[model samples]
Target: MARDDRAVGVSSFEGQATSAGQASLAGEATGTASASGPHFAAGPPAETGEPLRHPPHGEGDERAGEVSAGGRGRPSRAPPSLSWLLFSRLVFPGIFLASGLAGLLTLREIVAPPLDMPRILSGLERGGSARAEALTQVHEAILDPRYRDLKADPELAESLIRVLETELRQPITGSPEFTVAYRAQLCRLVRELDTPRTVPVLLIAVECRIADTPQLDSPIRRAAAEGVVTALERHGPDCVRSVPGGVAALCRAAKDPVAPVRAAAAAALGHIGGDEVCDLLREMLHDDTDVVRYNAAIALAYAGRGTGLDTLHEFLRSENVRNLADTGSTESVIGDRTCKLLCRALFALDRLCDRSTEERLAVLHPAMEDLCLSRAPEEVRTLAMRVDLKIERFHR
Candidate 1:
């Protein structure tokens, strides 16, 4: 189970070899015993007009997987007629070429940057379907076979993370809009993967991006910062571990000036735990932002840290502890936060019940009940219910 916890990541650098010898396979594409290379004849004895010879009944395929005199599976791979090199070897990788072109076009379209939306109900309704479509295309171009290949191989997930970090850290030069847009798109794709094996790769990629997140106020930087928190929020503890300096980076980012980013950081730290992570979370308990403090309580409980439950206690009593699911925009940071708030609380209760003690749950019962009663989404309510089940199981 412990082994099952640490997940895989992604990479495209050392993906399938690009030098695929594209032989102009002109042979008979046969499914018979006499099929040969691209140039070979299909039927038996194209020259011999006699009856077909047999190797005796029950004597088929004497050399399974091995090449026979007829060059069965070996040389018959291709007649070697149609340019057995990477589209004539002159043009190495077509995918990378395509990616480069697509990337350029994407940059061309990224002329304008997104404007800031104040935390208003109306603003939250403004959406980004166009940007989302553009981002999806970019993710495919950047990830594609690389992401697919990495998901299939657990052995290479660690190295994939390393390569991604190295790649993201390289000198990023482009139009301000393009640079941020590209990085943000890549960062967002980190969670698009389904396999647990890709977790490490996604985790490190996000951390390195956050570490690379510039201190200045740019949309790209904000995106990077938000991406880190988003990933942690999405994957939780699965995103923890294996990242070299991830804890330190999150600890630092927890103090980010951006409220959403700071809340995200606090939320993420709970998924991963250590003496250092605990210390940072404890400190965040006193953070000026109510969002940060609220997230810190959940994280601390998830980490099984017996912290002073002051924030959670107060939060449970606050009237604003309910869901704000009315946000219609996917891009509004305020909407994102508002909607996720109750969900985050529900998620925390579930984690705490799964990983904490009966003693902790006793103190948590009131707040947990309040969260469970809140009109959260279906999944969030389910999470809250699961905690109740866990508590009952513990008592039994």
Candidate 2:
């Protein structure tokens, strides 16, 4: 005897006996089985020798049981609600994408950190755009209040000094324009630090010479010379004394072919007093460049030597003082240069005249009087008047 795997039930339909076993589906007996005489069972056709089979528990037949409980034929699954479909397709994915972005942002903060001296130095060592970028960060940090005292950091100052020294020792590779600019920026930052320890590296910059490049006058050297002046001014004579061969370095820069370098070197020498420094200023007074001569004269005055008084008197003479003023307004560089030269000369003259012999004042008084009478700029005349009054006090 064959055992039935499915439940068997019998029902009467319109005076005919219909067996549920004769139907191929759960509710197939409701209409089609009643109209047609009898239907085969759900498993297979009656002609086959195979026994009828039912799906095992927990299979797709569970839906069939649910339909049977509702007293209806098997129904199609209900379509997803509009809101559920929208959430699954669009809203959920959007939320997931936002979460992913936030995670990445947090990770980035953890992986890459803020800038510091060691990192900046590493970038500088690599050269090229990285070096330029590192300098830019240094500039920004300089403006930041928290980092304004970077010069006070001994380790950082030493690191920067080494960087400047290395760049000078090795001929830089890469685009000329880029390399020049990078070196210029690096030199400028070192200068801004105004630390006395940087004097040696700055001296190297003043003497830097690139092989095979036209016009050996490097902007880096000019910036370095300016830095030397700043450092000397801030730290005084002790700053130059601390470095080996410091005075000799200034002498080398004073003899540099570049006029600006000589001018800066001459200005830097003014901070210290010595017969040797006075002699250097006297030699620089013969320089063909007017600015160099002017700086040398001022430096000699700073060294308290009256040797520059004659040079100062010449700077205040009517023709030299009024030449630029007549040709162009004080707004022009030439006019401004003349005006500044005159003012500095007057100031230096007043210093030299203090407790000075009549011979020195006698030579300087005529130049001051002429400058006051000349068609010089207001500021120049104003300073000349002050010097004239100071000289008058000596006569009184």
Q: Which candidate is the best by TM-score?
A: 2
lDDT of each: 0.55, 0.73
Model 2, 1-396: lDDT tens per residue? 123322232223422443434453533654333445455434344556676677787776687778777989756678999999999999999999999999998776556435677878787778667876777887777655555556676776776787788877777576767677767778888887846888888877877787455344367778888898788768888788778888888888888877888888898887776888888899888889878888898888766677776666666554656585454367767677667666666666666667365456666677667667766777777777887888788777
RMSD of 1: 31.8
TM-score between model 2 and native: 0.59
Alpha carbon lDDT of residue 100, candidate 2?
Answer: 100
lDDT of 1 by residue, 312-384 (tens): 6666555454433222332556546655665666566666666656464565565556545655455655666
The stretch of ten residues in a row with the least summed lDDT in candidate 2 is 1-10
